[model samples]
Target: MTTVAYQGEPASNSSTVARTLYPAGSELPFTSFEQALDAVTLGAADVAVIPVDNSAAGRVADVHHLLPESGLFIVAEYFLPIRFDLMAVSGASLDRLECVRSHVHALGQCRKVLREGGWRTLVSDDTAGAAREVAELGDPRHAALAPPAAAELFGLRVLRSAVEDDPDNTTRFVVLSRAAVPAPHTGEPTMTSLFFCVRNIPSALYKALGGFASSAVNLTKIESYQVGAGLNASRFYAEIEGHPEEPRVELALQELRFFSTEVRVLGVYPAHGHRRTERSG
Candidate 1:
């Protein structure tokens, strides 16, 4: 059976994704993203399911910084609709709650409910961890904001269900493996993720990205960050909506490489179904 690793307790959002993708697989949880990725690298787990970004909270894990350094490749992507539940000990009353606890992202996502309750906020490493703490504390006055499944996992009662501020909040997760498994170029919708560092010259970035526009290749996302302890050295992480093997995409990448000091193709995976749904909607 596949051993899936993720950075959260059972029933946390990451666990939910793991179960959805590999129902028969055993799950291994770690305290941090790095630890989970390390498990996959060291052959302790087949792959790691990690959250990259959320609609409501923006970036969850800095995958741009972590992926290249970890030497892992993205094998697949999943979109999880986020829902937070306010939960506590069995006898907890919503009106009598004095404090709320959750991961910082959960707290930020459920601001509407937190604002109405006027409760003190405490941050935990994971939303499920917060619920576990509430159950262990046996304190009716302290409630946790966590995934709906977390209440059942930790034997806590749900004070409120679906408390997220945005009804359509969703998180994007990536499956990482130690080896590259580039999807076959079969004309299906695909996403190519890569990292590149442009040569430090005038208009280097602008010139580097011009290839995509000229080739009519659609770039879905791109972001730059400083590298090598120098303000002048900038590296970029980008996602484009085509397989690298395609003629236009290949041409664009060639042009990109011509102007870049370094270029690495991180992954080329089939695009998640949610991307199509989102674009059509």
Candidate 2:
């Protein structure tokens, strides 16, 4: 069976997406995104499934840098709606709880719930790990904030379902493979993600982006991230709609060459649809 490497405990959203894509693959868990990429690069796993963004955490930079350098290519995509639940040992009550345990992200998402309930919260490294701790401890006063699936997996009972601060939370996942796969939706509206460095000059970015404007193409997203250590250089990652061969898209990239230090087209894939927010926890 092919092995899929994911960065998180078994019940994490990343692992959930991986299993959805490669139902028959052996799942490998890594403590970090870098390690998951290592598994794919060293042939320990056939592919790595990772989250790139969450409605809550914004962007996951780990996947951005690690993927570019690993020589692996993103071959597929998945969007998982996020949900968090307040879980405790079976038959436990919320009023009896002392402190709640959860990942930092989860803690933030469940802030109001904990604060209003007069429960102290402890940040743990993983959501399911925290739930497992609560299950093993079997303390009536102990509770964890995790996904409903995690509560079920760890045999904890859900004290209250869908406790996240935002009901619209969703995370986008990318599946990478050693072998490059052609852009998935040649005929469908697609999104292309790429990074480029612009020369430090007035109007440099404006000149580079003007081609898209002249062609009536929309630049959907743009963000700058730092590269290099102490004497830092910055690079920009952008997402645009359309194929590379489209005249406007071609000219935009060509224009970028005159102003950019480097340009890399990371992936071109079907655009993600509007996140199903009401489904979030």
Top candidate by TM-score: 1
lDDT for each residue of candidate 1 in 14-98, tens digit (9 for 90 to 100): 9999999999999999999999999999999999999999998889998988888889999999999998999999888988899
- Worst lDDT run of 10 residues, candidate 1, spans 224-233
lDDT of 1 at 210: 93
Per-candidate Cα lDDT values, in order, are 0.93, 0.79
Once superposed on the true structure, which residue ranges of model 2 sit more than 4 Å away at CA? 229-233, 275-281
lDDT of 2: 0.79
Model 1 residue runs over 4 Å out of place are: none
What does candidate 2's lDDT look like per residue over 1-281, in tens digits?
Answer: 98999877877777688778888889999877888888999999998988887778787646656766788876666788889889999779978899899888778767779888898888876787888889899997999988778887989888899988888787788887787765754566666777788887788888878877887777877877677665444678787887777777788778878888788887776655542233252
